[model samples]
Target chain A: MPNPTAAILIIGDEILTGRTREGNAHYLAGELVKVGIDLRQIRVISDDHATIVAAVRELSASHDQLFTSGGIGPTHDDITADAVAEAFDARLDVRDDARAILAAHYAARGVDFTPARLRMARIPEGATLIDNPVSGAPGFSIGNCHVMAGVPNIFQAMVTGLLPRLTGGQPLMSRDWMVMVPEASIADQLRALAETHPEVSFGSYPFVQEGHYGTNLVARSTDAAALEAGFAALQTAFPEGK
Target chain B: MPNPTAAILIIGDEILTGRTREGNAHYLAGELVKVGIDLRQIRVISDDHATIVAAVRELSASHDQLFTSGGIGPTHDDITADAVAEAFDARLDVRDDARAILAAHYAARGVDFTPARLRMARIPEGATLIDNPVSGAPGFSIGNCHVMAGVPNIFQAMVTGLLPRLTGGQPLMSRDWMVMVPEASIADQLRALAETHPEVSFGSYPFVQEGHYGTNLVARSTDAAALEAGFAALQTAFPEGK
Candidate 1:
């Protein structure tokens, strides 16, 4: 069976404007890969309603799971919840459950539940909440779309809580071999080796350090035997101390 | 007139698998912002031919300019040039000019131009070469789509050579202000302030540090006067040390 596929939609003006470098997508990609989910695509888009809604709908329909990070805050610019609701054609309002969670958390700290803060309680109808351990503001999951915070800490916490609940396939295994040779010198042989093992995927990453050119060849596969065989082939092709 | 719009397509399996963190998008985003180009979206996809071709065609048609990084190396996994050609319905073959460039560069280093290395000379028909100062392999531009190397140093060099030739708008100016208050407490005021300045764009980034909550508000505009005016309004709304 094919591994479950996922797509990530990162929404924020700070990322688009280059004011903030995104860390959530990279974090999620690693986690998803470990869980045997194929992360097919990741898109970073501006904080706009139409764009967010379109991306959410398209990604959710195509991929087995969709994760979105950013724009779910109490600021005036936060519009992710509303856009998601519009995408699913669901009603959006401040639910008592979400409000209660926020209210109690804020009350414990002796903070007022200001109207602006209440905006965080607004969720789409028929959605379940994703707990935020770092902050009180909860994320939500409507159908296949799981919405999470933009902040690295909070996003990590939410993902930790969410991943185990989803079904996963056999985890992919990867092995790497580094050789002090330029990629072009070995391209034909590498291509022939890859063709010999159809089940495994091969990738060659070139680097230049200290006036020396080298390539890091990585072999990946869900089957451990295939991965090992591919790695052995790669090692034999470019033995160390050559 | 609005700023010229562009989209980026990052092609690599390592990126999707989280084996490598991409740096080219962030670098390109910052450069595009400074030159007044609106980077509308960035999509990271794997090295699969069909996927790369679809993304290349879609992004190239929609945006005024399309920048693709990765999959243009000499390895078996590198297939970006062929995918790009398929996207534009153009033929792919090794041209004499590209081969000459590679041959000269390799000869200077006293390296043999193997058949595998010659693969780097393949260029889509009717494409102009984008120089790679860091490496001998050249990137190309077919239509508005500029295909470049995935390596950070080579990509940066190509972008430096490319951006100066493209049309640019007025450089964007921005100012940032930080306040030691939760975003919820200032959302309404911020909304009002943003409404007052139609020419400027406001963004609120929240943070929690040292048991204190705060927000960093950023104002951006192509017009320097409008940006300054927006900054003043933000300062008046959230006075410092208050």
Candidate 2:
């Protein structure tokens, strides 16, 4: 069976404005790779309502699964839940369970659960909560999209809690050869190797280090035997790279 | 006048597979903000022809400018130029000028100008070349799209060389206050400030550092005077943030 495809929608104006560097997408990308989920695309867009709704609808409809980060907060700019609800044509309001979580956490700290604080408890209809261990508030999974907080540590924590529930395929196996030569010098060998190994996907990355040009040739496949054969062929073709 | 809006499309399988971490999007996002161009969106997709073509058409039509990186190389997987050409309805082949540049560079190094090496010389019709100083091959600008290399240094160089040719707008001015309080405590003030100053965009980012949670209140505006006024209001509203 083919690996399940996934897409990530990053909703934030701060990232688009260059105020904060994006970390969640990269983090998710690495995590998904471990579980053999194919991350086909990643989109970083602003927190506009129409944009968020459109992005959620498009990504969710196209991919097997979707993940989103940012815009779920206690501030005025936090509008992801409303936008996502509108996309799926679901009603959104503060749920009793979510509100209860916030109330208990805040009551222990002696902080009043203001309207702004209650905003975090608002969730869409027909969604299962993804637990946030660091904070009491929970993220959620509605349809194929999982919406989580923008805070890095919290986002990472949420993903850790969410990945185990997902269906994963076989982890890909790969081999690499680092050759200290201009890519042009080895283009013929790389092309031949790529053509010979139809099961493996090949990549050639060139870099300049210490005034010498080099190419890192990588081959990846799900089949271990094919990857081993490809590696042996690589060693025969470029012994210097070994 | 409003700033020119732009989008970046990154084409690569390595990034999607988590073999490579993306840096070009973040670098270009910061650079675009410096030149007063509003970066509206960023999309990272794999080396699929249909995907690249669709993304190019969509992003090019929606924004004032579009920038692409990766898939311009001397390997079989290097299909971005052809996909972009197809998207714009232009002919793609090895152009004489691009070929000459590669030929001369190779002649200086005394390396064979093999078919694979010649692959780098392909250019779309009606496109102007963007110089790659690090390597001899040139990237191209066809219509609103600027296609460049994916390598970090080369991508940075191409952007630096290309930025001066485009029109620029007023640089954005921004101010921020770091308050040792949960975002919930300042949500009301943030909402009021957002409503009062429609010209400025306000954002509240929460972080937990050293076991204490805090909020970073940021305000941005193109008008320096408006930003200064917003900073004053922020100081008055959250004196503890000082």
Candidate 3:
């Protein structure tokens, strides 16, 4: 079978307009990789229903799992829940389980649970609630997609709560070798090696120091032996790694 | 007329893996906004042809302009040029202009112009070259889509060189008003205002201070007068500005 793959949907105008830098995608990428799920794509869209609906439909069909961050807040622009529910043709209403969680959370904080705060309790039909410990707003899992909060702290907490429940594929293993050789000089050889190792993924990152530019070669694969073989070949080719 | 909008495609695994914090997207978003182009979407994809091609095709069709950062270097994993060429159905070949620029750059730096370095000269057919002052690998513009170097320094320089050439739309104007009121209490009022000003985009950013959470309300639009009017009304609703 092919490798398990995942995608992320970031919904917020704050991110698109550069008002806020997003941390959820990067955090989720590493988290998914640890569980052997390759993060295939991440799309950041404004909190528009058409955009969110289109992205949700496309990503749901392509990846094994889809995690969405943002737009599940209590404001009017937080229409991701409604849009996602519409995308799946699922009815949306306040869930008893989610309401209980939010109510309890508000009580603990000595805050009144206003009607507007109930917006967080509204979830799609037939969706599993992803509990949030950091805040009262609960995330939900519908089909292949998991909808979470836009707040980085809340989103991270939701991911931690959700990761253990899902089934994962093989864990990805990786190794890196830093070479002092200029990237251009080793382009042909690296290309050849990349073609030879079809199962492995190799990447080169160039860094400049004291007016000299060199590259660090990273090879990753689920197979430990193949990863080692790829790393060894890379090291042998660029022995001066000095 | 609606404001001209642009989308960004960030191509690199380093970014998704959290190995490299992205500076290019943030810079590009600000530059696009300053030039009166609304940044609509941003998608970060790995060095995969199918993903890059699909994202480029979708974003290119939806927005007035599309920009791609990273994967234009002279390394093996730098497949963005080929993918973009294929996406546009344009042939990729060593352009004489790009070749001349890279050749002259290498000569000036006293670095050997190897065949692998010639890979940097490859450009999509009918593309305009975007000059790179930091490094020799030149960025290119194919139709409305601008492909630039991924390195922060080089990408910034290329954007400065390219932005002057494009015709801009009505500059998007904005006004920020901080509210001490909780988002929940203002949800109803904000929703009513949002419905009234259908053309303007309003977003709420919540922040925590001394264990108290409040929100900053930002109203944005291409119409300066409308934005100011909306800001005035919004501030009146929440007179106690925090």
Candidate 4:
């Protein structure tokens, strides 16, 4: 059976403006790969309602699972929840359960539960909350979409809470062989070898390190035996590491 | 006039599988912003031909400029040039000029111009070559789309060669103010202040550092005076920083 495919939608202007570099997509991609979910695409868009709504609807329909990060805060630009609700045509309001969670957490810190703070409690109808162990504001999962916080720490915590519940296929395994040869010199051999091992996916990444051109040939497959065979064949083909 | 819009399409399976963390999108975003080009969106897709072709066609039509990175090598998995040619409905083949460039470069190093090496000479009809100072393989530009190498150094060199030739608007100016206060506590104030400075764009990024909650308010505008005024207003409103 094919692995379940997923798409990530990153909503933020900071990323587009080049203010913030690291995001939840990288971490989520690694985690999803380990859990046997194929991450097919990742889109980084601005904090706009129409764009977010369109992306969410489109990605959710195409992929088995959809993950989103950013725009779920208390500020005016945090419109992810509302956009997601609009995408699913679901009613959005402050739920007692989400509100209670936030209220208690804030109360423990002696912070006021202002109306703005209450915005975090607003969730789409028929959605389950994804726990945020680091922060009180909870993320939500609606339909096949898992919405998480933008902050790296909170996003990681929510993903930890959410990934295990979903069904997964066999984890993908990868092996790499580094060769000190130009990719052009080995392209034909690599192609022939890849055709011989049809089950393994081959990727050739060329690099220039210390003024020396080289290529890192990576082989990935869910079957351990196939991966090992492909790796062994690659090693034999370039015995001197070139 | 509004800034010219641009979109980036990153073609690689390594990114989707989280095998590689850094890519060309971040570097391109910062460069585009510096040149007054509004980066509207960035999409990272696998090295599938149909997917890359569709993305190229869509992004090329939607934005004023489209930049693509990856899959433009001699390896079997490198199909970007062919896919881009299909997207533009242009015939792709080894052109004499491109072949001459590669032949001369390889001859200097005493390397054979193998058929695999010759694959790098394929160029879409009616496209102009973008020089790669770091490597001999030349990138191409068809219409508003700029196809570049996946390697960071080569990609940077190609971008440097291309960006200066395009028309650019005024560079965007930005100012940031960090306050040690909960975003919820300052959401209303932030909204009001944002409204007062209608010319600038405000973005609130909340963080938790050393058990303290804070928000970084970033104000961006093409007009330097307006950005400074907005930043000053935010500082006055949150003098205590909490």
Candidate 4 lDDT by residue in tens digits, A74-135: 98999999999999999999999999999999889888999998999999999999998787
C-alpha lDDT of residue A80 in model 1? 95
Interface RMSD of each: 1.1, 1.4, 1.7, 1.1
What local lDDT score does residue A158 receive in model 2, on the 0 to 100 scale? 96
lDDT for each candidate structure: 0.91, 0.91, 0.86, 0.92
- Which runs of model 1 end up more than 4 angstroms from their true locations? none
| Residue pair clashes in candidate 1 | none
Clashes of 4: 0
Chain A agreement with the truth for model 2, given as TM-score: 0.94
Model with the higher lDDT, candidate 2 or 4: 4
List each candidate's DockQ score: 0.79, 0.73, 0.66, 0.80
The candidate, 2 or 4, that scores higher on TM-score is 4
- The CAPRI classification for model 4 reads as medium
Error of 1 at B82 (Å): 0.4
Fraction of native contacts in model 4?
0.80
Compared with the true structure, model 3 gives a TM-score of: 0.94
Cα-based TM-score, every candidate? 0.98, 0.96, 0.94, 0.97
How well is each residue in B4-102 modelled by candidate 2, as lDDT tens digits?
A: 999999999888877888889989988898889999999999999999999999999999999999999887788999999999999999999999998
In candidate 4, what are the lDDT values of residues B35-66, reduced to their tens digit? 99999999999999999999999999999999
lDDT of 4 at A127: 97
Candidate 3 residues A2-78, lDDT tens each?
66788899998887777778888889888887887878788888889998998999999998999999888888989
